[model samples]
Target chain A: MSILIDRNSKVLVQGITGRQGGFHARLMMEYGTNVVGGVTPGKGGEWFDGKPVFDTMRAAVKTKYADVSLVTVPARFAADAIMEAADAGIKLVICLTEHIPVADMMRVLAFCRQRGTRLIGPNCPGVMTPGEAKVGIIPAMVALPGDVGVVSKSGTLTYEVGFAMKNRGIGNSTIVGIGGDPVIGTTFVDILEMFENDPDTKKVALLGEIGGSAEIAAADYIKTSMTKPVAAFIAGRSAPPGKRMGHAGAIVDGGEGSADEKIQALEAAGARVAANPEEIPDLLS
Target chain B: MKLHEYQSKALFQEYGIPIPQGRVAETSREAGAIAAELGGTVVVKAQVHVGGRGKAGGVKVARDAAAAERHAQAILGMNIKGLTVEKVLIDEAADIQQEIYLAITNDRSAGQPLLMTSMQGGMDIEELNRTRPDAIIREHIDPILGLQPYQMTYIASAMRLPRAHWRSFLKILSGLYACYNKSDAELAEINPLVITGAGALLAVDGKVIIDDNALYRQPALTAQRDSSDEPESERLAREAGITYIKLEGQIGCMVNGAGLAMTTMDMTKLYGEAHGIGPANFLDIGGGATPEQVATALSIILSDANVKAVLFNIFGGITRCDEVARGILTAYNAVQPEVPMVIRLQGTNAAEGKKIISEAQLPHLISAETLTEAAQRAVAAVQESA
Candidate 1:
């Protein structure tokens, strides 16, 4: 009943020959993701982890019948790989590569939108439907199958909160890392709608950071549309304005995108906002 | 990645956008020479990154070359909003008939590039948006189709700009968009696009902030980065592939991810409230960080004299916990840190990581099982030291 993915999903690994792509591909496969094939432009007609490799996504898609793609190509080539996946008729593409140029992402989002393909991230840990299938870089150890849906902008915090919650006997239906880039393919509101409709998701945990009005928009959506109980945590309370705190999108610019603004908004929306990630499990409970 | 006025103007000129004839000078003599060459009353504007330079007296109009030199002397080396003015732009002053604000930037909410303009210029756009919302006109450009001729005309007409000036206005607006797109800029702005006494449009001031991610492709713009504008520690952190921002607290923080690092800071602040202390710095070693980078991050944090304790919160995903523990030991040997330290390692080989730290037997090192415990311990260490 997990949203976005399950054990039945057929996944293709783009840039499967690269270091990160290769490593995470094995992890995803080990976690029971139906990774059918791999794609590397020049190194086609090869085999990686017992899966067939092809030169182009179009060829791989035709042969493998993969509906999903995990793009772990280098930052410079990631956008092109995403467009390639969309062009090949992949319904969903998750890009875990970080530091992609925002301009490239703007074009990629437009291209994907035109093709009706849902792109997840350019600088994010990918999605995980725990105990069913996992994509991207979320560690298998932390993911446990249950009813709470988790979405976050940060990869490690997602792991931290999910791991802690799992230890407290609260497992997750799905965990989505939408990335911490100024321009991302999916937004918190987008995932919130899906989580609300999923019958398996009884509650949701949102992890947001400083930057963008995504949290504010999420709060608006939560107040008006979401019926599920939601607990949230907004990071970077101590961050100063105009400083990029690690993530390119995690900057408090011109007095906007502060943690206080986001926390206040979420609390006003009837969702409990945690002062720390450690408090989120109790709030969700 | 914010370009100075002179740099933005240079880029504007390259894109066929008209800019006042000007050059940047580091010395007053050079400024006077540029002023004289322009052959009219000139304005000496201090080149610094912060806004409100006009209010700070960083801007002055000189009626003559000598006056320009004097103004340059006063403006140069002056401090504006914590940034030192090292250069000045000497340009011919325009006879303004009207001021218009225009800019092109990414609209994250709309997921498109936005063009915002106002007839009321020489004021902050946010202020204008608040005080006179109707005065601002905006259009979202499709990233694929880009800024079309019709959209340009629509905006110009909406502004009620005279038909006589539409052609020039369209050129400048489209040129600015082209610069914005080609440069991969997050923002390209011409504040107070003036209608001169001659009935010609001129860009009085310009600003461009290139996306930091896109800087890899923009080598020329990357070279234009002003290193003097940042602190030495920040510069070192950037070079080490770590994200570090200095703060005025006592606990030095090193975490794996940006969100976790920020959360760690928040946690320290929340718990440190009792001890009257907080995180002294925000440092993310980034995913897949090597022991060398961790050691480097530690050195950078320890270098901050304000730091009384250090907190390491590493949740291993792509980043391994054992490697970080080894890095901590390596840094401990190198820096001989006297301040107490709290380390929390979880997920992805947490057992091996804990074993490494225990075997290192480093002095002043404490272990915590959870983020809450780590933050409390870090603050307690700071309090004990104090």
Candidate 2:
């Protein structure tokens, strides 16, 4: 019932010998993700957390038949790692690395698109199918299995919104962190389309922040197609103009990508917009 | 990461694109010397990161060295949109026959770099795009294939550029694309790609904004970063690996993650709006931040005298609550913050974190389980103190 991934998905961890990869690999495994193997270029033929380690994604996929990949490589090698995963026939790849060069991402995104492979993020928290499987860095305890599907452009905000939903006794079927980079792999429309088709997702929560027209475009999609009740929250309502609020993409440029613009767009699209995270549950209801 | 006009022109020159000879000068005397060397008429333009320098009288054409010095004196040390003009670019003026615009920027919706051109240039492109959208012709360049010659021809023809200027336009366009690609620039713009009276095409004004993430590979560009352009607290936060932005409010906020920090600000604003109070600052400790970094963030928040209360909202995933709690305690001892504090610790050893805060027995420190309650309490504390 989960979109993109579930407990049955065989996952391979790329750059598994690295600190971030190693830490998140264990966490994903602890959350019942089917992490079959890991790939660390020179550290092949080794074992990490009782899983096989290979030198390349080709070798890992051959041995474990991984359907998905969790890429935690450093920024410099993230694009290569993603392309390698996509080239190795991995249907889905989630990159958690941040600060990746934009040109590299452009190439990697093109490569993945050519192969019909879905890539999640290069600076994102990854995805979680609550109670089924977890990928990336979202804390496992914050999520629960339910009918609401959540998607956000931020990691911690995803956790905050999920926690808020959990507090209201509402859980999520799947939650996707699409990253906050200016040039990211997935868009709000892409995740919204996936959520709309998932049978278990009775309602959806779309969390966005300042910057980019993704929220506006998502509103258009929701207005035209989405039948599920969607509650939306846009952050940075009080943010000053022209200041980059931490995220590379979260900047107000040329009077575009402001919080007010996004809120108005989403509200006009018929989705209830929450003033804060606490109001998300009621808005969805 | 936005390069000044002189920097962008330097890159443009390196890529073999023609630009009016220019040199950056810090002092008005140096500007006059450069202007005298260039001879004839010269333009003294202020070097700042913001736009609308022309409207702010940051750009002026001087007919002689003395006039150039006067312009530099007027433009330099002048504050344009809150940014002080520390340097000015003195360049030999050109005889403009016509103006055209050329730029390369990422089109996020298309997921590719877009090369936009307009026959109407030398003015506000935003206003042009808004008023006459059809005047600007845009073509998305595949990052892998790059800016092909055919694509350039397509755009040039679409703009109905004269046959005589096509060759030079294509060369400049290619060079501009090269500058954008080689420099790792998110945006490379040549407003007023002027066709001179002497039948030469030159980039009159250039702008290149390097991708901050790609700066690691661009050592030269990274070195050109103007720290003076940023606020003191923002600079300190960057050094400490925290994300901080100053605001005009009474309640300071420190949270984990950019999204959460902004949400915390929004919540504070929502509850505090009625009380005529809001968050004083936006500070994100970032994921996996150390205790010392947290302490540094606290000190920075407390440094703001207008802050009547501080709110700490931590949802520990990679950031451990206990580590943050320890950092808070350390900062409390060091900064001796007089303002009332509301701390909400959740996720990852939150119980231990709460125990640490409670055991500290600081009268000003208050703990909450939810963001709503924490924001409400922080606003109420600020109101009561006021």
Give the Å shift of residue B256 in candidate 2. 0.5
lDDT tens per residue, model 2, B1-386: 88989888988999989999889999999999999999999999998998999999999999999999999999999999889999999999999999998899988777799998999998867888898789999999999999998999999999999889999999998998998999888899999899999889999999999988898899988998888988788888888778899999999999988888999999999999987999899898888776678778988998788999999999987677888899889888877888899999988789999999999899799999989999999999999997
Using Cα atoms, each model's DockQ against the true complex is: 0.83, 0.76
Q: List the residue pairs that clash in candidate 1.
A: none
Which RMSD does model 2 reach against the true structure?
Answer: 1.4
lDDT of each residue in A17-65, candidate 2, tens digit only: 8888899899899899999989999999999989999999888888788
True-contact fraction per candidate equals 0.85, 0.70
User: How many residue pairs clash in each candidate at the backbone level?
Assistant: 0, 0
The runs of at least 3 residues in candidate 1 whose Cα sits more than 4 Å from the true structure, single-residue gaps closed, are B273-275
In terms of docking quality, model 2 is: medium
